[model samples]
Target: MDILVTGILLGGTYALIAMGLNLQYGVARIMNLANGEILVAGGYFAFIAYTATQLSPILTIFLVAPLAFALNSLIYRVMLQPLVNRAKSRGQLESDSILATFGLSFIGVGLMLSFFGGDYFSYSFMAVPVEVLGNTYGANRVLSFVMAVLICGALYLWLNRSRAGLSIRAIGTTPASARLVGIDVKALSAFTFALGGAVTAVGGALISTYLTLDASTGVVFTLKALIIVIMGGVGDVRGTIVAALLLGILETLVATLLDPGLTLAAAYVMFLGILLFRPQGLFGKKPT
Candidate 1:
């Protein structure tokens, strides 16, 4: 029971982390390697706000989200749009984006290192213990989980119920067809990319309340988000949520029953199994 509750809380946050990447890669068709950096940046914003202003990290989302969105939009316009225009094929664009964002990741790391130095940062917020199902857990973790649930739920509704969301889904499903139907694929892709960055930043703000993070820690999150996105299938929101929960449970079980150090290895093993057997993801339909 303890493991289940803990893992669910952890997976809820992971869902937020991966959802942003899914939006970027699934709809914008840009494989952003710097995604984790954006998340880390969001954490930094929360850390700064909490330390300087004594503001709650949860409330920092309003400030972080828009800032991330603007910066990400600028990055897309200045750095990625040219590649999108010049690429000869989807494969080429993806390859170019990988290289471009890989460089961007390094730049982000360097900037963070220069400003913040290489030290771990954490803050206490709602740090009291909360009992659930005969197990005690940190209140911050529970709060973060609740916030994640609300944000994800709202996002799901927007995607499924709104006209703009339908267009975004159409673009993700078939960009060419969406274009044929008069959707401005380029403009919408840029919006999706920026929105993805904002969502990822919000995830970071929530996570900073519970996790120790440093300038270089972003890469770890980047890889984790990548794994979750792939395992869930690109653009599949439901799959991402389910896969994140499964991963959380698996990691919790492994850490509790085996060695804590083996949790990451366990994740890799699962990822490998998914790639080998269900390359299209657990919920994703096989490509025709």
Candidate 2:
């Protein structure tokens, strides 16, 4: 029963981690390999805020999310956009984005290391936990999970039910047409990447409080998110969330049943197995 609750909460956190990747790769189609770094940065940033201000992490996100978005925008503008704009090589656009994001990812991680040094820092705030059907635990973790769900739902509604969302979707499906119709793809791309970054920041703050973090700590998060993103289907927001939950629960179950060492390998094998049967993902549309 405890494992079940743990897995559910952890899965929601995983979904939070995946939201940024989904926005970047799934909706905007940017292969942002470095995005996981944003998670690291945001976590550290929240730690700093917590250490200094000693405020609740929920409040810390308000202080951090905007910074994350701004940093993400800067990263896209300075490091990534140029590659997309200047590349004349034979490689596809997505390939170039991946390479560029990889380069930037390394640079960002290195810069972070240079500045902060490698150290594990954690933050926590006990605002009191509400009993749910008799189970009692930290309210902060549960609050973080609920906030993650609400955030994802908000993002989904914005994409599916809002005008800006429609425009963004139109741009992704047919950029040339979108441009012909006067949609600013460049601006939209920046917005999309920033959106991803902002969400990652929230994820980072939540996860950092729940666990420990180092400068280069987001690698596992990145890998898990990437797997779930691919297995969920690129550009499918809903699919990403659903896949994250499924994978999170399954990973938890596997870790319990087998050795902890096999958890990653198991998830990898699961990804491969799913791909073999449904190459597009659980919610991805079949390619034409």
Candidate 3:
């Protein structure tokens, strides 16, 4: 029961980060390898705010989210937009963007290391424990999971019910068609990436309270999120959430029943098995 609860809460954090990656790669075709850095930056931002104000890091979400959005938007405008415009094919654009983001990741790592040094950062706030179904645990994980659900729910509603959401979906499905319909594809793309960054920041802030983090620490998370994104099918938000939950449960079970060191290996094995059997992912439609 403890493992089950922990896995669910942990999965929520993963889902939140994966959602951000989904928007960048699935919606905009930007293979942003630097996404993990953006996430960790958000944690650093929250830490700075907490240190200065002596407030709970949760309160810094509003500040960090927007900052992440702005930074990611700046990157897109200055470095990625030109590449997108010049690429002759979708494949070329994706390939070039991957390399560009890879370099950007290193830049982010360097900056973080230079300024923050190599030590792990953690907030000292204490969370009261909460009880559920005869299981009790720290409130921080519960809060993080709840927040993730709320954010994901709101995003789902926005995507399904709002005009802007429809535009985003349209662009994801058929960018050329969306452009023909008078949608400003470029502007919308920038907005989507900003939104992605903001979401990632929120997740980062939440997790910062739950785990130790450093500049280079986010790479593992980035890889995990990438796995979730691919497993859930690129750009498939709902599917990604489901995949995250399953992965989380699997990881928790493995960590408990076997050596914790094998958790990532278990996840990778699942990923490879999925790729071999269903490359389109569990919820994604088979590519034509």
Candidate 4:
């Protein structure tokens, strides 16, 4: 029972992170290896804000989103845009993005280590324990879960209902067709990346309140997000959330029933099983 509750809370954070990746990699078809680094940057932004101003961390969370958006937009303009413009094929562009973003991740880690050092940082939430179904849990975890749901739900609505959202989806489906139809593919793509960054940053800020963070800690999150995104199928936003929660439950259950040290390995095992049985992903449609 305890594990289930805990896993649900953890799942909320994972969903946010994975959802952002789904928008960038799954929808845009851009393998952003630095997605995790961007998440870390968001956390660091909140951390810096809290430290410098001694303000409420919750307020700082709002601030991190725009900072992340701007940062990713800058990255898109400088590194990704030129490559995207010149690429001969989608396959080649995706390959290049993977390598380029992978290098960018390392750069992010190096810069963070230099400035923040290799130390773990966390914030005190001063939250009290709340009882749910006779089980006690931290209030902060509950808050994180609620926030994740609300934010993701709002995003889901925007994507399904808004005109700009339709444009984003159209580009993802067939960029050339979208372009011919008058959608500014490049501009919308950049906006999608920026939006992805903002979403990830919000997740990061929530995560900092939940875990001890270091410059290198975000790689684990990166892997987890990738796994969930793959499990949910590329570009399937709702599926990503569902998969993240399920993975979290499975990981927590395994850790509780077996050895805690096996949790990470268990997640990989699940990933492998999914790939072996459903290469198109759990929610992905079969390719013709």
Give the top-scoring candidate (TM-score).
1
Model 3 alpha-carbon miss at residue 147, Å: 0.8
Cα lDDT for residue 15, model 1? 94
**Model 2 misplacement above 4 A:** 88-91, 127-134
Selected candidate, larger lDDT, 1 vs 4 = 1
TM-score ranking, best first: 1, 3, 4, 2
User: For each candidate, what is the lDDT?
Assistant: 0.94, 0.81, 0.88, 0.86
* TM-score of candidate 1 to 2 decimals: 0.98
Per-residue error at 66 for model 3, in Å?
Answer: 1.0
Query: Which consecutive 10 residues in model 1 have the weakest lDDT in total?
Result: 258-267
**Over the stretch 1-288, how does candidate 4's per-residue lDDT look in tens digits?**
888888988898899999888888855668888888888888887777777887665787778888888998999899999889889999899899989998999999999999999998887774689998899988878887888999899999999999988888888788889999999998889988888878988899888876778899778888889989889888888888888998889888988899888877877987998899887788778899
TM-score of every model?
Answer: 0.98, 0.92, 0.97, 0.96
Residue pairs in collision within model 3: none
lDDT string, candidate 2, 13-69, tens digits: 888888888888755667778877889888888788888988768888887789988
Q: Which residue pairs in candidate 4 collide?
A: none
Whose lDDT is greatest here?
1
Q: By the TM-score metric, which is better: model 2 or model 3?
A: 3
Q: Worst lDDT window (10 residues) for model 3?
A: 123-132
Q: Which ranges of candidate 4 are over 4 A from the true structure?
A: none
**Ranking, lDDT, top scorer first:** 1, 3, 4, 2
Q: Could you tell me how far off, in angstroms, the CA of residue 44 lies in candidate 4 after the best superposition?
A: 2.0
